[model samples]
Target: MYSAEIILEQRTRALSEINLNGFGQRHQGKVRDFYSLPGNRRLLVTTDRQSAFDRILGQIPFKGQVLNQLSQFWFEQSSDILPNHMLSVPDPNVMLAREAQMFPVEIVVRGYMTGVTDTSIWTMYQKGSRQMYGYNFKDGMYKNQPLATPIITPTTHAELGGHDKPLSRTEIIESGLVAEEIYTQIEEKALALFARGQELCGKGGLILVDTKYEFGLIDGQVAITDEVHTPDSSRFWIASTYESRLGQGQEPENFDKELLRLWMRSKGFGGDGAPPALDEDIIARLSQRYIGCYERITGREFESDLTQPVAERIKANLEGLAL
Candidate 1:
């Protein structure tokens, strides 16, 4: 059990010694590369690669830093809500997190209906269907409609090229992956975190619309793992215009992947094929959006030296790791 500071030191050392040819490549997700570390812990590195609609687009400068810092901000803020697997942040794009058996489900909670998935929900409503993946939905709902209360919709984590399927609580329990008591604990903690997130965002003049959460078992206890309320895991809407946008049937101004999704859709590219290259202007605008998200959410200016070379910065941070 390394303290956060020690873990950060170790990560810096490891980065200094990172073999470009053999960093013990463990697994590669859409935008992250996982490297094995001592014990069961793994080093998660956020690369510059950008992915939308499940397809990897060209790399965007500093995109990885934005994600890493965003996750770090949320982890620090929400530690009081529940224990997270965060051990330390080794570098701007690297995290030392606890190794746990990841529960196969992605827990999604929605406060307001919006976006493509929400549209899918409405389509199900119009067909008089009360359920999606066995979860019931009431009929005749309009867009951006508020739920009587927030609902938890769980979906199974899928492999590459595979689609995640929704699962009922009952199914999750019967699968024997987790005990009913533990599953209940996950539910309680997730909602509590979301509530806190809502409160914090409200103060920031933002609305936490919806988000996905992942959990893993640490020493037989379920804990929040991976990233928390970052822009990647959650949607943030400008608070002031939320009501006006809903009344006018306009989408709320948001800070999240929605903008990238819109760009992809405009080019008639879905997730299945290669994505079009984003122009420099669009890239610059998106970069600013990420920076803005950090400042607005944390109420602190982002003071990163983006002009420095990533590899050099990483090498300096890892100086202590050299044996």
Candidate 2:
């Protein structure tokens, strides 16, 4: 459990450049570092790096723990839906997982027609395009309105921070990115997972607005890889205010990283180019938002060892682990 002042007072930092000497070949990602290991396993280290629109904003202290722990929680909660790559949690910020061959697409399920990114349905619709990601929308749709039904709007899985292109069901099937049977299986799993997420979030007074899931083929079976529902991979809105806010044509109260995105955009960076350095104050607030979501979702306090350096703490916790 940490307060904003506690976060700001912590001297230890875990940046994106951290390296584990004994770990195998490392593939650095935007917010995570993947280390390949023997027996088709991998060490996934979640860093405190904050990202938006496929661009790194800054590092939020302990944000990695929030993301890693949240993913573990969701994966276990939804394990009945499909298998996952998670092997164990060696540290709060690390996941030792099966090195499943991740698919080239990201399974994004949206319950509402909203998002500010270029690939978001709302953005595309606002630009006068009624057709997007294999979903047809009528002209009367308002921003943040719920869709007729939840839909799978998949996107190209851009490794690291590259742009993610939208993919329709037809394009995905016809292009042979994945066999129809396999893709459809994952699709059903994703939808079921989303429904499960909504059911769980409802009890917590949050709406599972939309979330992205990554599935990979492991042991000849489709298993979810990377993560499930987390602040970085999903959108969460306050459920009680959603209806009133929608009726008033106002944005619903949310605790996702879109706050950081809006702050970045206000600074004249619309994710088209490089962004200016983020202030420490905003970074602290962002860390609080992640913590808030974790607490609300799991109904548990987020515990972190602020007295130790994040990278050093990870190294110590992972000392005896077989990667």
Candidate 3:
């Protein structure tokens, strides 16, 4: 792992998106650029482009590599629990995966009542909403409070320009988004995965607050799709400070993109109007936070390959692939 100073100095390239037109049919999502390959496969490249509340914020250096590698780590760790769409990671920011019949709902599992997004349980609860996504909460609950048990809150998988709306299990099934049996299977799998994540992250001195998982059908079997346990897909807080912070009515130290969101919120931007230009200092700090989370969650050092440009490195690494 590089030192903080070294990591900042080496964060030279930030990938916002990839334009691999000739490679295959390209589909650019919010953060991932998909290049469809022959034989039901695709090259999924995670970019550094950050988004919050359906708004695209500026890119963060080394963020893509951290998210990709971290998700790869979690996918490997959780492979025994469920099959995933990942075939292999061709590059640090790329995953060669099977093209799946994806579910239309994103499965979100929460162990606590906290978050700043409108779809967040805490946000809804504060707005005088006692019931959310079929889960009813008692009147008295504080922010960042742990729940009696984890709850599954699914949301519609909206397009890039749209917001993801929360949905109940019944709503999902009634709306034909997912069948009841498949939804039950994924819900159990998601909870088990969350337990495994919490166990692993606890050993690493971090709290796996909550996370969203996407699933898809691969060969008629439900498989974990997209990223898992990444800072972009989950919320993490410093374990040691959680108790004291909550006792003091302070938000715990979060390592996810919530920091970026907080910064944007302070500047009076939340998925509206034009986003303020991110300065070099903000980008550097965000990169450091992402690296820190990666190291904490995986218990490994993050080594950057700064010798070549990101695009060149990915292209060279993927030369042997079928894409």
Candidate 1 vs candidate 2, TM-score winner: 2
Single out the weakest 10-residue window by summed lDDT for candidate 3.
Answer: 1-10
- Tens-digit lDDT track of model 3 for 1-323: 44546545655656777776468567888889888888898789999887776767767778899989998999899999999888899899999889999998899999999987889999999999998999889998999999999999999988766789999988988888888898889988999999999999998899999999989999999999899998888999889999999999898988777878878778898677898777666777788888888998889998878776677788788777665
lDDT of 2: 0.86
Q: Give candidate 2 misplaced runs (Cα > 4 Å).
A: 159-161, 272-274
Looking at model 3, residue 33 earns an lDDT score of 89
What is residue 85's positional error in candidate 3, in angstroms?
A: 0.9
* Model 2 lDDT, residue 249, Cα: 83
lDDT of 1 at 81: 76
150: Cα error in model 3, Å: 0.8
Clashing pairs in 3: none
lDDT of 1 by residue, 129-154 (tens): 67764566665677777777776778
TM-score of each: 0.87, 0.95, 0.95
Predictions in order: lDDT? 0.72, 0.86, 0.86
Off by over 4 Å in 1: 1-23, 118-120, 133-135
